[model samples]
Target: MSNKVTKFFGSPWGQRVSLLIIVILVMILFQPKFFSLDNVSSILLAIAIYGIMVCGMLFVVIIGGIDLSIASAAALGGSILSIFAKGSGYTVEGFITGFVVAIVVAILVGLIHGVMCTIFGLPAFVVTLATQYVLLGAVLVVTNGAYIYHSDFGVFYMLGNARPLGIPLPIIIFLIYTAISAFVLGCTTYGRSLYCIGGNPVASGLVGIKTKINTIIAYIFCSVSAFFGGMILVSMNMMAGAATASNAIGSVLTAIIVGGINLAGGEGGIPGAIFGALLVGIINNALILLGVPSDYQKFVQGVIIIGAIALNVYTSRRSENMKTPLKPSKKTLDSAQSAKL
Candidate 1:
């Protein structure tokens, strides 16, 4: 019992589980709506939004990189989708063209991120930071700083608004994407290369891994993921705007960190990311239910993030310490020999 307790406390998985339980208990105490079917459905839907992005962001994080431009990427994709579909009268051709174009742009964004970092020797964070503004500026130029609304999503309506098997379509997509990501990371050569590269780009290059190419691929995945997320958000709102993802990076980072993926890369998986995303979803819902004022919610959320980071750091260091055995002092060794004798 004691060992199990220790394991639960010392491991990220166990800690998240405990945190989940505590959150549930608190919700039950202070916010009864937390358990309602409607509320549950809403939370799941919300999770599917950022959840999809988190899943894609996993590849980048595992490669020891960061993306500060996810919000802009998402905004651009959704904005473009709205514009194309609107221009063509929301017809099937417009939808198809918009979808393809959005994908291409997403890939291009990722390529830029990867190339600048891998070839030009820029820091991932710095590259993404610069790209964030660039993408945002592009959105402003394209939309002329206006929100584009679409009256119809055509066939795409199902992706954002439908609920089959009592699950929101976004949630379903999130699950499918998560499964695919898990498989690719767990079972593919590319996945293994990503891990290796993230562990040490220089050493991996010596082993014949194309670190630059893989880094490019990782960034593309991140941008593409953000694109999908943006589409879903636009579908739900029936509008695309530049500010849609303005505050999203912090949430995504919190999810990745909370999920047990090391910020340093190559140490975490989709399971942790999912848990972290869901945890954020639940907390956000809880705040709304608890009547926390909008002005203070951000502050509270920051505090929670700080706490999770400290806990993750503590557990990571503890796990590392456990791997290295202690060397006994000479005095202790001599005392032990005498006692045994």
Candidate 2:
């Protein structure tokens, strides 16, 4: 029994699950209201927006790439949508036009990211970081450095806040988005290629995988997801600005890391990512419930990010150490000796 217990905790999934249970237990003991229906809904709502972005970012991360521009990209999406809707007096026709244009813009941004990374051979980090500034600049220009508020409660508002059967629309959208991402990554050939390309792009290319196209698709998907989430977010707040979803990139990446997805890429899954998001949300909520100052909360988040990365590195090294080189079978060795004789 002791050995079994030890083994369970020794596995990666087991360790993560244990940590989640421990965190939840701590929250319940210290803050009984943590599980209140309203509080739980609030936590889910917060998780939903970032969770959608996490799904998109997972694709790039799985392919050994990163996008630091998620927040800026989201801001651009929301700002564009708000501009169109507001410009047209918030009618259904205006909202649809804005939605389509925002999505197209997202696709274009993603295409640029993909081309730069794959064809131009730029580092994902540098490319995304640079584009992040460019995107924010675009947002500023469009909004004239002002927040665009949703003047009327219409389709735009319903997109984010509508409750169907007592569940928030954003939450529903998040779950659906996650499910689709999981399906693509787990069930499709394209998804399998992502892992291969992430693990070894050259090798994947040699094996007939269209590495460049697949990578481009992944980046495009990431941008589209970011935009979709951003739109929902702006709708919920009834406003859009450069600061909208400003912390999204950090939150999404942190969730990905805490879920044990390697930054080096080629090793991660939907369940782990979701678990990481849930844990982070819970921690943030706990800090608030405990009356931790905003500055301290940021400090804690930073520490968590650093600690999670360190833990990932440590575990990766440990796993590598556990691998034993293959040895020749006894029959093969005997045959060699016989042949020598």
Candidate 3:
């Protein structure tokens, strides 16, 4: 039984199952109505939105990097999509074109981020931090301190409001993206390279892996994830503004951390992150049901983040300690004797 428990926890799928069980138990205990069809749909909706971002975020995090600018990128994407999607006219063809343009803008932002970090050899932390601010400024500039509201959402509204076959469309979209991301990460050479680079960039480079190229690609994907999530947010809310992605960075990080992805990277995958998003969404739902203030909710989330970080550090140290110790070469001893003589 002990071995079985350990083995079960060892795999990604097992971890997700365990998380799901825990979330279900918590919901049952605290919010009995959580199992109702309406409440279940709401939970799934939140998870779907977050899952979209995590699908993309998994790439960046697995490559031993972070993308702090995701929220800002999403805000800008949402704003652009709103303008193009419903601003002037609601023709289906025009909205589709505008949506494409907004997505392109997001990709361009990601490209710039990747170039600055990979090509210029800048620290990921510093680069992403700087880009976050820059993107924030861009979002503000785009919105001009105002929101673009669409009272009549036209066809674009279907993205958020549609529930085909009683399941939200966003959830379907999330599942599709999840399938693609999982396939890429689990079945492709690029995915292996990502793990290699994150595990040890220097070693990957020495072995002929294009670390810079992979890093660039990872960042681009991460930013694109932001855009996808942002567009969903706009569709869900029927509006876009500078605050479109507000608190998004924190929320996404929370999902990653709680989902068991190591912040240092090269560990975990899409499954874990998706489960983590679900767990976080559950927490959010519980909080809402309990009528907890937003400030207190933030504080609780902060505690969760700190706890996850501590766990990551502990596990990392334990792994390092478990490794075999290296022995010194004989040449080093000879050199020491010579120096003493």
- For model 1, how does the per-residue alpha-carbon lDDT over 1-341 read when each residue is reduced to its tens digit? 99989977766677889899999899999878789999998898888899989987899999999998999999998888888888888888888898899999999999999999989999999999999999999989889999987677466566589878866888888999999999989999999999998899899999999899988998999999999899888888788889876657877887887787888987788888999899988887888898887556567668878888897677667766675467565577899999999
**Candidate 1 whole-model C-alpha lDDT, 0 to 1:** 0.86
| Pairs with backbone N, CA or C atoms under 3 Å apart (clashes), candidate 2 | none
Model 3 misplaced regions, further than 4 Å: 2-20, 312-341
Which residue pairs collide in model 3, if any? none
lDDT of candidates 1 onward, in order: 0.86, 0.91, 0.83
Off-target runs (Cα >4 Å) in candidate 2 are 295-297, 315-341
TM per model?
A: 0.91, 0.91, 0.87
How do the residues 125-243 of candidate 3 rate in per-residue lDDT, one tens digit apiece? Answer: 78888988888898788778788887765778888888889778899999999999999899999988999988998999999999988888888888888888888888899888888
Write down the TM-score for model 2: 0.91
When 1 and 2 are scored with lDDT, the better candidate is: 2
| Candidates by TM-score, descending order | 2, 1, 3
- In candidate 2, what are the lDDT values of residues 52-169, reduced to their tens digit? 8999999999999999999999999999999989899989999999999999999999999999999999999999999999999999999999998776888888998899998999
Q: List all candidate RMSDs to the true structure.
A: 5.0, 4.8, 4.0
